[model samples]
Target: MPITLHDAFVPTAQQILRAVRGLVDKAERHCAENGVADSELIEARLADDMWPLPWHVRSCWVHSGYAINRFKTGVFTPDFTDIPDDWDAMRDQIDDALTQLDAITPDTLEELAPQTVGFELGGQRLMEMTGQNFLLSFTQPNLFFSCLHIL
Candidate 1:
């Protein structure tokens, strides 16, 4: 069978988000077992120039469920504000993303596939493409990148 836009995006995004949730649980367990504070892991980063753990987690949500919602608006803008700095909040973010994904039916994505979505940053339009392309080419990659960093 030919793949639909929903088949290509929603399930894949949800799987990645679920994996992220599992990793978060493991990190919390590891921290607890090692006598390390949860905040230490929350604030930790692989490099000085990169955002901390919370940002990666937040990005997963932003690039997946949040990005889907933005497709309806015909513009995609990266939101970097209000990243959660605590464990509970981080989990909540993931949970919220999962919930959002669950609400998106296949017909929703099919209807959006041909619509134009602009990629904007800092009041500038960086690119424009069909919603399908925006999701598969851009949002999906960013979602994976964020999930990888979280690992």
Candidate 2:
């Protein structure tokens, strides 16, 4: 009875990402059922200083995607230049993230576990840690934060 690295990372992240997709579906349904434009929700924020709803959804995908990408490559770049601005595009973003995460098999997670991983921001090295810590501490928390905001 032990929790392997694959159990700790892939399935946990996949479950949260799947929930992110569900949030997208719910948003679409809510808008249609109420005859309210998706923008009405997507563009709204809990406060003026906060990022809008779409940003939250995008971050959920981006954070998880970055973990996968960075674990494989040791580098991450901010490239939301083609941001998803509509409901369909948002759902596609989540789907694309799910696809990327799905590619990380149990074997892959095992390979990554003892390796060093670095987090980069703005073309500068941010921090480096073991892959396990990076996935469990930084990546999972940020991804969950994004998901929580959707509710």
The top-ranked prediction according to lDDT is 1
Give the distance in Å from residue 117's predicted Cα in candidate 2 to where it truly belongs.
Answer: 1.5
Compared with the true structure, model 1 gives a TM-score of 0.97
Ten-residue region with minimum lDDT total, candidate 2: 74-83
Candidate 1 — what's its lDDT? 0.92
Q: Each prediction's TM-score against the native? A: 0.97, 0.90
What does candidate 2's lDDT look like per residue over 68-90, in tens digits? Answer: 77677755554555668988888
Off by over 4 Å in 2: none
Candidate 1: clashing pairs of residues: none
Cα lDDT of candidate 2 equals: 0.78
Candidate 1 ranges with C-alpha deviation above 4 Å: none
In order, candidate lDDTs are: 0.92, 0.78
Candidate 1 residue 2 Cα shift, in angstroms, is 1.1
Instruction: Determine the backbone clash count of candidate 2.
Output: 0
